[model samples]
Target: MILVTGATGNIGRSLVGRLAGAGAEVRALTRSAGRATVPAGVGVVEGDLDDPGSLRPALTGVEAIFLLRTGDTDTSQILKTAAEAGIARVVTVSSLLAQTHPDSSVGRTLLRGEQVVRDSGLEWTILRPWEFFSNLLFWAPAIRSDGVVRAPRPGLPSPAIDPRDIASVAASALLEDGHGGKTYPLTGPATLTPQEKIAAISAALGRPLRFEEDPSLATEDPADDLAAAVSFPGVCAVASPGALSTVEDVTGVPATAFRQWAIEHADSFR
Candidate 1:
């Protein structure tokens, strides 16, 4: 059986469905089982990653795990518990920033989690994905209200990955062998500037949209902060040189393009 932490999140939600769709015994761990909605035939167990002791019930019968780092969670202890529970494999979702911008706060946190998993003695695969296309959802409100996206860097480009692609890679690593001890850096098929992304959304929504470069835009919301962080100029460049092939190489499917993702999720901007 495979246990998925952060089961309700963007990547974890897709990961659970992908595993179950493949006929794997899947269990989803959530802080509140009452609130989590998972695929049929999947088990839901209430647990808190922040408190490692709360994970025991969820860990029962789990042979492999998809570990997603949550805020300040004690990863070392979690891995210790998983090892003690006899879970033999772990697939973790980290960020490319851990490799590209190691000095950054987010990079440091993710690197620490990766180290813990490596030290756990379990068969492990780490996924370091670039900015998620879902981060564009941060502009939903502004787009809905005025069809305008205002951000600091309009020309900066990112090969922003789809979270589903990240989940697909994780599923392969968890369910297949030959992936242990490997770290995969993942990205979308093409790099796109904010203007280009807005154009894609506009075409998807069948309407025009605007991109405004506002250097003074303040990021108060966590979502906005994340979107802004990924827009940083050098973060994507460092990771994108050869990382774009990882999704296709690992999953036998090409990495998703931002325009396609934008089309699929156009309702959010509408």
Candidate 2:
């Protein structure tokens, strides 16, 4: 059976669905099974990554795992438990910041998690995805209320990716062989700035939206350092290697574009 952690999350939700659709025996691990909505025939079990002991029930009979790292979890202990439970393979979702901004606290934490997964003695694949298109949902409220997106660095660009594509690749790595010890950096097909993204949303909604450069909107909280780093612009733009075709190469499907994602999710902004 394949175990999916953070099953209610963006990527995990899609991964579980994809696995189930492929007729794989899948189990979704969430902190609250009662609340999670997964596909039919997929098992739902309550487990917490922070408390590895709680994962016993979820890990039973599982052969492979899609592990999603949470803030400050005991990754080593978690992997040790999975290994002891007879899980032979693991696919982890990490961030591109671990490669581009290693000096930052968030990057360091992600890198440490990846290293632990690598040393866990299980066949492992690491996915380092760039900024997610879902991050634009942060502006949904503003757009719905005033048809305006107020943020900093309106012109800074990033080759942001779709969370579903990340899930697709993760599913392939989990169920398919020949992916062990591989680390894939995933990105969308285009690099778009905040202004361009707003334009796409505008077109999707068939309305006019404005982009305001408000530097004050940039977050200063240390707790949200990763969000601030990716949302504000300069940090990622300097390090992005441009758009990559890894998504298509791995899943045999082209990476999603920002405009297309906007059209699909336009209702959120409406």
lDDT of each: 0.84, 0.88
What is the alpha-carbon lDDT for the whole of candidate 1? 0.84
lDDT of 2 by residue, 31-119 (tens): 88899998889999998899999998899999999999888889999999999999999999998888877888878888888999999
Among these predictions, the greatest lDDT belongs to: 2
> Model 2 clash pairs?
none
Off by over 4 Å in 1: 218-243
Q: What range of 10 consecutive residues in model 2 has the weakest lDDT sum?
A: 230-239
What is the alpha-carbon lDDT of model 2 when measured against the actual structure?
Answer: 0.88
Model 2 misplacement above 4 A? 219-227, 231-238
* Tens-digit lDDT track of model 1 for 1-270: 999998999999999999999999999998889999998999999988889998988898889999998778888899999988999999998878788767767768778889888999999999998878888888899899999777655445678889999999999999999999999999888887778888899999999898887667644443444445655432222324433789999999999888898889998887
